[model samples]
Target: MATTSDPNQKTPLEIREIQELAIAISAKNINPTMLSQEFLKQTGIVPNEWELGKQPVLGPNLSQVTFQNGVSIVAQPRNITFMESIGTKNPSELNIPNIARQYVDKLSNAEYQGLSISPKSLIPFPGSENGARNYITRTLLSPGPWQDYGKAPVQAGLNLLYQLDRCQFSLSINEAKIQMPDQSSIPALLFAGNFNYNVGSNSPQEILEQLKKGIDDWSSDLKDFQEIVNQRFLAQQQESLFPGA
Candidate 1:
């Protein structure tokens, strides 16, 4: 994923290119002491260790330009390991070639990280509601971007697109809330790391574990209360979507 200089944009980027950037900024790598030292060296602000919330940032930057068709983008990742399968859905059906699998993993992880943070994975499982919530908050939400959703449109700077069918996604900005027809369709965002870094050398599993530890420590009692409210809201949403289950 090499980058080319474009004179028009503030950054060197292409107009319609889809790129994924993954980095391992784990807790062990970026602790309060390290972050404070770096911030002090750069900005001289001596940032309060608590202000950062000590979250572990993982995965790649999922940045993309407009789709080929002008109004839509289809997300059919080739290879990924889901927590649970979506019925009989198969990754091969997505039609992404073997050479493109690296892209698939990068993009999928990005989507997973984004969705897990805001409100995607907040819903409780049928039998183990608390267990499900805690797992997500600890494993995924804790180390991932739990607080990214509110600032997604701005900080992430990716337009919200609706998933009309399967991997099909369409751009819709008429309303404040973005909709998705398929849960797997991930929107785009800026890549936060250097693209020239070695691609085949990333230790994915170890990096993920490191991130999880960071988030687990950074989380607080307030996050748990928010999860409760989110759970209730999700339950209500389910009831509205399906009257009787």
Candidate 2:
């Protein structure tokens, strides 16, 4: 099976699924031990009826709670992370960003440093593992002797960072093994994106407002990442791969 280089190809890619979406907030004064089911219910960060998937961990340095809805909130001494497995759901319906904003709103007195919104996806190569390897060496990178230095075929990964108008964006691409429901696994490429936003205000209230704005822009950022991968990178017309552009 040959991979299509036409960006406008009517056929969809083999597999494109969002694995996870996360929002991590950096704070200096948060106590992880304060996180608990009772605390969440009392602060109204989560609904009272929400049940935990497992027993909550209320340790001195780390606290975590996994909800039945696939949302997990983990709190460390200096950072709090809200994450969810998106599976096949639309990104617009994700609730982790809103929940992170709400948590910050409730704990308005913590000293916040910054926040990052991240999403990861898995896309399998159309053919075999060699086809995926060629994408990095032949398509992305120019042919050179550096690729042939090793005894075996070189396994490569790519990481890129860009400064956008609103935040710093980072993208990482690497090969991953995706486990199937039938106890099998297949090789795939993992695309991870992080949008880092810095709070420029000193007041906690102002910081909260800034975070809310960043959260609101998450959907657009996600779309930008998808476009970069599907349109710019994977969609380039390669004469060698297609045999006639």
Evaluate residue 9 in candidate 2 and report its C-alpha lDDT on the 0 to 100 scale: 23
- Kindly list the per-residue Cα lDDT of model 2 for residues 115-184, writing each as its tens digit: 8988876665434557667777777889899888868998889999999988899998877655544444
- Per-residue lDDT of candidate 1, residues 1-245 (tens digit): 11222223232111222222111221111122222224332443222232332332222322111211111111222212111111122423321122123223333243222111111111212223133233334433344564446743212122343332212222211111111232221122121211111122336564344334322322222233234434632334443222344
Clashing pairs in 1: 21-60, 142-215, 163-181
Which candidate ranks first by TM-score, i.e. highest?
Answer: 2
Model 1 scores a TM of: 0.18
| Deviation from native of the Cα of residue 78 in model 2, angstroms | 0.9
Displacement of residue 140 (Cα, Å) in model 2 is 1.4
Computed on alpha carbons, the lDDT of every model, listed in order, comes to 0.25, 0.76
Q: Best candidate per lDDT, number?
A: 2
